[model samples]
Target: MSVHETPRRPLRVSFEFFPPKTEAMEETLWSSVEKLAPLRPDFVSVTYGAGGSTRERTHRTVARLVSETDLPVAAHLTTVDATRAEVDDVLEEYWQAGVRHIVALRGDPPGGLGEAYAPHPGGYANAAELTAGAKARHDFEVTVGCYPEKHPESPHFEADIEMLKRKVDAGASRAITQFFYDNDVYERYLERVRAAGIDIPIVPGIMPVTNYKSLMRMAGLCGASIPRRVARLFENLDGDPATRQLVAATVAADQCLDLAERGVGEFHFYTLNRAEMAYALCHMLGVRPT
Candidate 1:
């Protein structure tokens, strides 16, 4: 629709940010968080790096947000290289720090995405285990990841849904999907999920594509598809960063509005620790700063 014609239904949004490695990056992340805070997202989440590499940074960032912002913050906790005790200790720390929500994950290998994934010698086996452990440790509201296109390791979609079912049974309250380009893909996945009787909220993960080449590489690693039209939108703007970002914002905003038409109320944005695009998206969706 037009800029003035927002979706009539109310929308719920959340943004994801990664822990920063440098002082400058941390400043940028905090600025973005500050800018978006007034819009009042459903919750804001900080990502844990692969294999718990950013455990301390993630904790520090979440604690700061809890202390400084009124926003409800969700800390990401992963089952990767750490032992069960180590992971449980982090859970206690989060609870003590006033974090009530967790994004439990089975992270990639310590070696990175291309490397083979293995549980630690004594760690939780997967996200389901982590979810159960998180709930048992502190009664945190747990959210787990779901792959609408099926996880790269899963042999089929059924297997993926079964894994999600296990997470739900383990007390996860919701699932956030991997970023998807096609709304039809999300709808089909939702249909299948309902058919299988897994009814938890599956919030769509929205990623604004500002850099075409970077997105292609990331999408390849994560098994997210790139539609040709999306590629075409960024085709000749590689040298024009400003124009490309505008296109990115428009493309993602259109996707979100379209999703609103399809009965989706909740959206989780992968902010890449930047606010402009995500802010633009919310504005377009009629979420004004309050």
Candidate 2:
């Protein structure tokens, strides 16, 4: 290390996990949780499935986090097919169970990805409306979603920025972006967001790519483009899990390091309910338990 080299900033990170559906998956989820718990991330989030299908399981997992660990847990809530009353009840349930933060979203419809989303007959119409609803019920610290590469459904970038501003106005405290391989995309998005006067913490969502095929599928669905250079790095590692994991950790750590150099200090990892890759990325970024 040279004296002229720049100092790395302290990084604050959070992990996202999903509710387990089966007994073995449940055990796996808890084991992953135990492994990452020691790092004491800023907060941990649990995802809600499309159309809120995993509502009960998400609630159960969050409640257990509250009771079993001294971690700050954020529960994902989505307005998909449920009415406002139903959504309100779920928020109250989380409140009673000691969850304070929420990632409110207008989730994918039950029809699945690429299908047009129509709000429930008596439900909040979009994420901005959902944010308002959550704030009305309780003074929750709400987080909303953002897309660096314009959302697939959005007509243009300007419209996406407008929607984010509306969500902020409706009481959302932060916005987490969809995962993207290009840090420049995020930097440009931040400029646009600030130019539009939406002042909120826009956390970059980092997804460590352990499986190339699965990553491409999600990137397709979310409109994140995989730069050909990155694609070249993972080419032909399909049958070699060890090499694949190494490439994944290195790619993700490089992404985080590049962003950190640009003055971004916070990151939210889409853990896919695994610990090794995310844990390794954090270590590479110099983040450790407090």
lDDT to native, each model = 0.88, 0.88
Clashing pairs in 1: none
lDDT of 1 by residue, 187-248 (tens): 88888888888878889999888678988987887778888877888888989998987888
RMSD, each candidate, Å? 3.6, 3.6
Q: Which sections of candidate 1 miss by over 4 Å?
A: 1-9
How many residue pairs of model 2 clash at the backbone?
Answer: 0
Candidate 2, residues 94-132, lDDT tens digits: the string is: 999999999998898797777888989999999999999
Q: Estimate each model's TM-score.
A: 0.95, 0.95
